[model samples]
Target: MNQLKVELIVDNRVNRSTLSGNGIRNAVSLQPVLYVGGIPNNNHINLTGSGLNAYGFQGCLSSFIVDGRLLDYQRALVLN
Candidate 1:
């Protein structure tokens, strides 16, 4: 299975020795949403970047746990 892991730790300061070999982007990011891609909405053509690209997530999210708590993305989507 092709897998990729991205761990973001929000901390003040910690021992760097404990850090793993994972791709650790040490500096905090200003734009939280690093990657952005979506289908164009013809209805809202006035909106900027509406017809950008179609590269949104395309796979089943088996699991998404944050702080040891499993999140309900499907339910959230329906609510919104």
Candidate 2:
């Protein structure tokens, strides 16, 4: 089975605002869908390490949904 990985990097703050907004509400900001024609005997699709926030949310404000799943998390960022 062939497998593929997809990663989406975005600004947590901006993405969260967009999601909360009335417009563009029911759409996945990152990796909406995949179109593949024909059928494969053995094929595997994996969603790993996606929707990564480029810069960690600097406060308790920012969220997003992936595949109809909502994830809310906010904390201070420590850089080394």
The candidate maximizing TM-score is 1
- Worst 10-residue lDDT window for candidate 1 reads 21-30
Model 1, residue 12: displacement in angstroms?
30
lDDT of 2 by residue, 1-80 (tens): 22223333455322232122222222223444322232233633322333222233333324444566655333212320
| lDDT value, candidate 2, whole model | 0.33
State in Å the error of residue 14, model 1.
22
lDDT of each: 0.38, 0.33
- Candidate 2: the clashing residue pairs are none
With candidate 1 superimposed using the best TM-score fit, by how many Å does residue 30's alpha carbon deviate from the native?
13
RMSD values for the candidates in order, in angstroms, are 13.5, 15.2
Cα TM-score of candidate 1: 0.28
